[model samples]
Target: MPEGPETHALADRLATLLVDERLTHVRFIDPGLQRRRALLERQRVLAVEARGKALLTAVAGGWTLYAHSHLFGFWRFVDDQDALPDGAPPRLVLATVRGVAALYAAPSISLWRTDELGAQPYLAKLGPDVLDPAVDARALLAHMRTPRFARRTLAVLLLDQGFAAGMGNYLRSEVLFQAKLSPHRALEDLATNERRRLANALLDVPRRAYRAKHDDALPPGKDYLARTRAQFGFEVFERKGDPCPRGDGRIVEDRLAGRRLYWCPGCQQ
Candidate 1:
């Protein structure tokens, strides 16, 4: 799935290319959207913004192009007849006036009224986006402390967009592991310090992921994940069955919330 960082990166790139450009043409290749062609054609793009894992393209025509990659969807910008960038499969394509094309593939795509966007059932349902600078960590913490949220496991809660936006499977697993909270532990079962730690980690990880690329610069042969782990590489998540970076025990893998969660039980617990 394209997480918050990936989506934000796409929004940043697309914003640069599409913003202020008049739409020379708009094609609704998806059969489901063919009926809306009159509304989509020749609309100018005003801005592109991202909320959580969804992308919003504001059009001067008083509508917004809203899409979510859910799991396999993503977008690419090609200039002057350039080929689509190599990555996930594409399901939608939007070409612009500068001879640039904004390609969206394998992701759910939809168009809605700019005025009606806030009323969209899904947008209204989303929790605070972690990457949203306006998201108040303290406020979010207070919301989680409510009796209704107390019994939910941190792992499941993190994945719930209504709980906190911008967290996907990778962020959920990494945050819990970093905070040393068991996936099975409920929100109420966590100490105040633990909850704060988890929240802070959530804010930090996505920013780092957004700026850094996963590559060989990552420290070799270490298992312990610190705030510096991105610099050192990784603490857990994808390094399953490899040596524990913390030197406590080899990386252990288990299913939590129906998704694979990896950790050094000794280190994390």
Candidate 2:
């Protein structure tokens, strides 16, 4: 699944290609969205933005096209040299004089009035977007102290979109590892300094990922003492049974929050 960083990068690329361009044609391969195709055609793209794992295309009218890639969806662009493929599923193709931007295999795509964007159920519940440059770590800390979140394990809270949108399985594991905190630790159990570290890591890790994806560099690893750049990426994610890069212990995996959680027993204490 493409996480927030990848989705953000996709939005940036799509904006570069489609912003300010009028949609010459709009094609919805998904049956659900087909009815709205006529309404989107010839609408100028005002901007393209990413929220969590979803993409939003603001059009000339008051409508914003929302598409969530979910687990297996993607967007592809094609020009004169590169041709659009045939038989892609649930694709919403937006074409202009320059080229075509086709969203393929996406699970959800629909139209929302711009005025109602704030009222959208999913958007309404999300916490501060970690990708937002102005995100307040103090505010996030306050939100976590609420009754609904105060007693949850870091494993669960880290993956909560309502706690911090844009966090996925890999990021949750890596952030905990970076903070040298165990996933089993509950938010209420953490000390002020520990909570500060966790909050900072939550914001820092994903923004690093956004930069790495956009700048074409490797995501920073959890092993802070790593000697070189090559050694400084993804300390615990997908490295189960492998020796910890931090040399504290072997990396291990467990299930948490309905997803795989990876950590090093020796280092993440």
State the C-alpha lDDT per candidate: 0.72, 0.79
Question: How well does candidate 2 score on lDDT at residue 115?
Answer: 83
Model 2 off-target regions past 4 Å? Answer: 30-32, 80-82, 216-232
lDDT of 2 at 98: 84
Q: Which lDDT tens digits does candidate 1 get at residues 1-269?
A: 87787777677767767788876666656877867866756777888888988889898879998888776554556665457666643466666765555455566678899999998767888877876767656867776766867888876787888888788888776777667777777888888898888787777777667656433343222122233334424678888888876687777777777887777777765
**Number of the top-ranking candidate, with lDDT as the measure:** 2
TM-scores, all models, native as reference: 0.83, 0.88
Model 1 Cα displacement at 263 (Å)? 1.3
Candidate 2 global lDDT:
0.79
What is the lDDT for 29 in model 1?
Answer: 61
Give the per-residue lDDT of model 2 (tens digit) for 1-269: 87777787788888877789988878787677788776678888998888877788999878898888888887778883248765644377788888888877746877899888888778888888777666767977887778888788999988888988898889999999989899999888899888888888887777777776534443223233122223226878999999987887999999998999999989876
